[model samples]
Target: MTIIKFLTLTLGATAFLSAQSSPIRSCGKPLHPKTIVQNDAPSGTVSKENKIQVALLLDTSNSMDGLIDQAKSRLWNIVNTLTTLKYNGKAPQVEIALYEYGNDGLQDENFIRQVTPLTQDLDLVSEKLFALKTNGGSEYCGAVIRDASMNLNWDGNEKSMKLIYIAGNEPFDQGRINYKETISKAKSKNIYTNTIFCGDRSEGIQSFWQSGATIGDGKYFNIDSDKKVIYIETPYDVKISEYNSKLNDTYVYYGSRGSEYKNKQMVQDKNAEVQSASSSVERTVAKSRKNAYKNDHWDLVDRAEKDADFISKVKESELPADLKGKSKEEIKKAVAEKSAQRGQIQKEIEVLSKKRQGYIDTEMKKRGNPEADDLGKAIENSVLELAKKKGYSI
Candidate 1:
């Protein structure tokens, strides 16, 4: 399985202008600005650092609202499951890329929209998931997979698990690109491609969904797209939610989008809650995971702590109001204080989350629903199995 890596680059004005002036092409056609960005990786060799990169290509065509809903509601559960994985006693970083295909709302030239490049920023992933709207359109599984595999900076490390899970209800063979070639390209790069058909198993198998998985050495699953997910609430839910709120207060916002990012954090918090209390709890659990709750891009505390010279690089005007006018030493002290507070909250959430998960597991077993084959479970099971084969453990 090939894991998706999100590369954030600070290119020179010349390169930036060139990329802006020329249109990005996918399958020899001009890609929509919102669809894909070409050559986004920083100039250098691709890193072989161990991590799990999974690209989720979903069909957002009409009558697939249930599929989208399942994704939105179960994302945190997937994160929580991934967090438990360890390789050589060290936790591997997880990055996810999102693609939405087969939506009438999108352009025909690129019916597929790269909702996000491979990214470790889970909040950004959540925001993108929430923004998806379903509409009738053509579903091109092969084209999207080829685009992602060709365009994204996938690490070439055989030790890393790189995977593409394309979920749709349409025939596997569609559009201009050939499914066989796409799977072959993925295999050539050591990327595993999985197929998830949101319909009957036999129908999916007959439609080439199972064959797609077989070609790429990945799993095939057919799920009832409209199945309602039931979550068993635990006694730790309230405390966990409270700690999540406290966790938010500890963030020290900075940079131009500081306030906006902070607000987005809260918005996602509410979005999780709206899905279900259990979903919110799972999200907080994800936040507590090691290497999961990163916000160095917009948070002054994280930036200052991660980069010793972060304060020196930023202009005075760019600093948050509270951080402004303070000496470097004073600013460092403030950030340290908030960091300590955040760490404490995260520790508490971690402890409570473990208990919550245990309770849910016990309840599920008792209810005889231990074998629920929902979207999250299917993805988690496949990822864990593949990770284990690649020397990872839970």
Candidate 2:
């Protein structure tokens, strides 16, 4: 059986950053300079599990607003697609880092900013994407790629798929840093660097975009940045949307950022709805994916269920008002109830989402074969292919 079919068959059975400080002398030992460190995993217990790390470097010059919009609209779809991937029967963790280059408003002289470091919190990634603004500035492909490679803590696991997808319309050699050296460094670190040019395919080839991709054994593509993404509304969209709303009710927020994070969840929901009903439905489907939706930090139920000592460690003041004054057994029972409800809702969404995907797949086939050029399709195709190479069944 093909790897893709193996992954689909398994699903059919189951149904479902850092900082530093000044050094000081202590106990006759000299302290070293405060060095900033970056971690690939989010804080908590570090697992030696395999993962897929993607760094997205976008050119945010005035003309690239369409690219940013596409990223915002397609982020959830990308996450949903990755959830289908598995290695040795275990789903790999997914983390994404975001960078914006070619924006004059950025304080860095190079006009590049690390918008968000590698993180598992997908909500934070969406928040930063929505906050991005475009301005005229230098487009330094090499410089941004070098900075991300050196600064972010990429995984040392040779089996893991680590990648950089840098998209822009500028010439590949526009910056002071040598493109060859930068890409070579990325290759040495086992990071595959894919380049996406926002223009004609021939123009991208002439501009060295294809060469840049070749330097790191990556794929290159040209996309029409201004092309609108078409999301079709399936018959199951309404029920799925309703189920999503009910699923949100299963979350019980706690901790200091509980209220704020809860509000952000609703805000993202609105953001997707404003784009299109189809986009919102896509997000609902993503939330149903086993690996795509996670809220352990601020959601009391998830936190408690994930960590054995989480409930005991949480301060009384940090608990949500509804959970306050409740006994330990009562809180545990309540959280368990919410968790069970969440699982049932997610299963329902998953059943409907499979139908939705089949419909979309049939529609695309009817539309005839078309080359993948847009940001979403390009990344999705590249990721799936590369992941398969790394022994992931997609």
Candidate 3:
């Protein structure tokens, strides 16, 4: 071939190749690889450093004051820990929801409340917990899970994960709301239902709650292991150690979220610290990243609204006719299919993220803070390089 002709051919090929690439946001650097990008589809780090909607269904049964207080006290640490995750340049996206069940009984049959929808506002969750009170009954764990499944505006979590934390003294199986059906719904959406069994000596409690967790693709923890302020007077230590072990075992502790909630924290102090963290240059990046997550989540909601509208005949056909009230295991068939659509959408979001990042960079430059720029860039560069070394090519 003539040299000129060959050069022309090569240039054309390159342009085509570039066009085929996932469009990256031209705004900022691709988060230096080390930082996580919001909306990275599953990248196997949903629990590690990405967005997750965590629902805390506490058991405020007459027998469980201890667990409620412990949950309240632990909120800040949990938030601090989650914020440390850098999934795709974004802090772990978090929206913690709350519910109370097993506290009401067959007379009223069931009572459920969504104290908070999925939200990044940790303080709101804490405030809601403060109002929690012990109610009636031996436990109706199923009701809470069902409520969360039926109510909360769950994030699609195709880009993240949805976790249901159920703490109660009763066996999960014995309730009007079937635990099996709840588990099914969770599985279909990749929603995990981790259990925190609080009561004692109930027959088959282990099988009921543990099995629920198993089928739901989640874990179960002995609430007794988690130190409860109410339980300290009873001689048993809150097994925060055991709790940490589960996170470690599952690799959920990657960003030091486990450590942040290690001890009692005064509300004022926790809030102050969070505020300070918010203002730090490093934190500013994290905040921006968090906002990126919100944008992406809404993007998915919009897509789902458009694609199936989540209600198209095609979408409805994909759902099991008897899909209603299915347990987590039974719901798996549907979740698997939806995953493909999510994967495609996620790639698009990643490209857009890169472009958006460039805009952020431009503003940083406009600030004209040389040392600050150097520090941010240096930090970002190291993170991205390390991520690439780790095989992400970020």
Candidate 4:
């Protein structure tokens, strides 16, 4: 071919490859982008610097349905607690990894499955957690812990808080992998391994659960997994829920499967609502915090905020139908409006959430605050203590 023709073909191929790799895609496309423009998936260093990494290893054996229920109800509460921590007076990035064990998964794999790798996508985390099922199988505490430690992209910063919480009723030393050695390896990497026994406290000690915590230099707690979680209703909850609805309206989604992911967000809201009024309210409050519930990967408003040139570079075909023919200036203006509106909604939710929390605290004090140790409380308490030790302020 002639030099000009060869150059034309090469440039055309380059453009095609760029479009395929770009997270920005045409609407109604089936290829859902995992990140933003230029594949904005958080790199380990960009996302994990001063990050709080939490890995939850829960046993999903047949008899542990109650434990799963508690986890579902309190996932938002745990997230809210983590959002309270501040490193250097700014919110630290939070990433959570989830794993299920003792579920009759695959025997060769030791009945373990890494549900989701550590991710900042809180909606995906909730989706995976709600989908978890239970079945009888071997509970290998050591193996799960080892898998989480080795597989997750944990933050290496000494100031970042790294934690592993394993909750189960089985003996801690039941796995082929040595619990003591695995926990020691985790500690060597500055990761604290917390053990939450689902049965009686003394039984947990007798079963070597306490030893696991001691070796890893973390907290040990035993909870009644079968007990129901009590939620306190406050007058502020209603107003907060109303604000949450408005907040949801401000998200502007683009790219492939954007609409599906948007629907998934609403479904998760319903899931929390189905759990209880308090859970729904807690989730709404968590969503108000940008540091806790980020959707920059798909939401145009968030992406615009993070990348100043995103609105300018986005192609007309990549935009939603309503925005397809709009000018770049018009699109930017629309995103700016949604962002401001969201900020107002979030502020309203935050004010009401604080009042709601205060009311709950007062009621608990009046009731003498019954000691009801459950999965969420176990993780929340331990996280607060450990975060403080890492010099993070609440």
Candidate number of the best lDDT:
4
Determine the C-alpha RMSD for candidate 3 after optimal superposition of all C-alphas: 22.9
* C-alpha positional error of residue 356 in candidate 4 after TM-score superposition, expressed in Å: 1.0
Model 2 accuracy (lDDT, Cα):
0.71
Off by over 4 Å in 2: 1-48
Give the alpha carbon lDDT tens digit for every residue of 1-394 in model 3: 0000010000000000000111111112111133433343433232333354556677666766666555543443233223333445433445666666655532345655556655644334545666678766656667667767656656553545466766665657775778888788767876766665553324325548678877776654443423422100111112221222222121111112222322212243344234332111111222222222222121222223235433222232333345445554444444434445444444443344345435544654566623211111212232233333322322
Alpha-carbon runs more than 4 Å astray in model 3: 1-50, 105-108, 199-207, 225-394
What TM-score quantifies how close candidate 3 is to the native fold?
0.47
lDDT of 1: 0.70
Say which prediction, candidate 3 or candidate 4, comes out ahead on TM-score: 4
* Candidate 1, run of 10 with poorest lDDT: 9-18
| Candidate 1, position 217, lDDT | 87
Backbone clashes, candidate 1: 8
lDDT of 1 by residue, 130-181 (tens): 8889988888888888887887657656777788888889999888989999
The lDDT of each candidate is 0.70, 0.71, 0.42, 0.72
TM-score of 4: 0.87
Candidate 4 collision pairs = none
Query: How good is model 1 by TM-score?
Result: 0.86
